[model samples]
Target: MRVPTLQTSRQTLDAISTRQAEQARLQNRIASGLRVQSPGDDPAAAAQAELARSRLAHIAQDQRATQLAASVLTTADGALAQGTDLLQAARETLVAAGNGGYNLVDRQALALQLRNTREQLLKLANSGDGAGGYVFGGQGSPVAPLTGTMTPTYDPAAGTQRVGENADYEATVDGEAVFMNIPQGNGVFATSSAPANTGTGWIGAGSVVDAARLTGHDYAVTIGGTAAAPTYTVTDTTAGTAVASNVTFSDGAVIEIDGQRVQIHGKPAPGDSFGLAPAGRQSVFATLDQAIALLEGNPTNAAYNQGLERVHASLDRALDGVVLARAHVGEALRGVDAGSASNQQETLSVTTRRSGLEDLDLAEAISQLQNSQVATEAALRTYASTARKSLFDLLG
Candidate 1:
């Protein structure tokens, strides 16, 4: 139905106002490079964009956390590397001191060198991250982990800090796991031939087959009987209990006891004996102390050989422990790097999606702005013309 004269002017004015408002909205979009000026523009898209933004923020936070974890691991890795070097040097010194040509004075000189190395190892053990936190601090502690002027003491507990998302490289390497509680004696079990053995029997390095069944015990393998009817017995020296008795001994036999297994690889005469002890953890500080003690002790004493053996064993385990620790650090670093790459990809994907929903398309926005301007001008001209015609008609 056609409107009355007064209503016609009002309708024209409303149409013009609507055109002007649309033109202003388009212009704003074009100038600001944004599609949604307010939630009303596209409520669903606006909500999606907000979620995308929150995801981006979370990604940024995860990136920062990953970086911090990497830094801490890097520091620990460097210190462990240094520790390995020091252990190697000490090993070389021990080997040199073992030479028959070396005199007491020479041994004493080596001792002094090892004392300095001990101090250096201590420093590495008690290393700080310069953030008022220690690299080996388990959980966290204000005091140093290793303290004391001579024979630095170790704190059994240390912190294990993890980084990253819920899955993948998020669990970080722990300090105590690396440096403090490393297994001694081949990192599994201690194997040795009897000190009183007159035969050429030997025991090879053994491994724990069943982790659950492994009972840390001191076991002695005593060989008796004739070569034809060789017999062996397993006795727990620590508990003073017998494990097995009168088992036939073979040239190469795999002995299993208390969930631990070992192989004897050489010929053994009657009265020969072999032993196995549970592997325990030791600190790098203790290894250095033993080395120093060997040099200070009487070289010709009856227990001199045993002491030397102990020191060599300790040093070897220390070196192995550091190497293992470094391996873990490297692994953690790789995890962080991988996590970083993943985060970057996710950020890119979210940003792209957000841009599609909220960012203006420059070409389309400009085109629409131009069309709106044209339409607004046309509406204004039509309104003015109709208003003038209505006045002329009324006058006539």
Candidate 2:
């Protein structure tokens, strides 16, 4: 009889303890608002929730990436804008330098102004990301990739920073393309007057008339007749061959050679020559620097005019490069915005999925908790009443 009583008591106590544990679990679920606290709670649901959480984390990371890219790109865009304005100011100074009414002193003042512009432009080119990194630092850049000297130097990286590997979403513009890799002279070739010439002739910026006919070789134009009836000859200095000889020289005449066309203005003395060569990369800084040097030498009226024209063409191209860069940055900002929107949407979807997997229903949990509490109280009362009863009374 005693052994049977001990077994009965142990069984009742186990039942009561189980009910209490269940009530406590319900209370915890209500307070914490999560149904699956551990994998053991609901293994499948917990696993799925973990996956959703991981996806959400990735979405968050992507959002951060796009945000960072937008910031860097905005900085680059603003710098390029300022750069454009500085280049415009420099162009205006070049125009002023060309003024015949402006004496050497006046042009020198313009040169000083141009020097400041060049410095400002250089500063813009090397603009930072506000975190000790270059905003225009393509793939990689040193602390200061571009030198700050009057003759700025740099070998800009090839590719820009980006938010994704295959994405066209660039975080920064290619500094090389914007500031260094600009076409010199015309897009095809450059022209220059011979330094030793005693003529008042100026070489205009040439253009490509026939791409197929261009030899991509250097050529020299030599004037060889009396001033009254001047004649010209074209020699391929690169190939040491005469392309044209004894061509009639006319003032402000177009001299087309091997597919390149340039105009000559003003009188030319015999032996006055001009040079033409394939276009190469001319940095905006170099262009400005050369323009600054234009007035340093007491050049002839013709030489000053020639230098002025060349500088103007380069400045035009420089301005175009900056505008194009700014446009590119704008496109990148739009891309970032699109990416950000997509990321936010994904985050919302994932959050919903994760919540469904692990989140508790407050109303259901509260009702379950109340029922559990009642059941636990009844179990304790029953166990206490049974414990007080004697074995002999139960047997009777």
Candidate with top lDDT is 2
Per-prediction TM-score, please? 0.77, 0.86
Q: What tens-digit string does per-residue lDDT give for candidate 2 at 340-362?
A: 88888888888998999999999
lDDT of 2 at 146: 82
**Winning model by TM-score:** 2
Residue-level lDDT of model 1, residues 159-219, one tens digit each, is 4655555534433245566555656656778777767776656665566778897677789
Q: Poorest 10 consecutive residues of model 1 by lDDT? A: 165-174
Clashing residue pairs for model 1: 137-159, 138-158, 138-159, 139-159
Residue 358's lDDT in candidate 2 = 95
Name the Cα RMSD for model 1: 6.0
What's the true lDDT of residue 391 in model 2? Answer: 67
Q: After superposition, how far is residue 4 of candidate 2 from its true place, in Å?
A: 11
Clash tally for model 1: 4
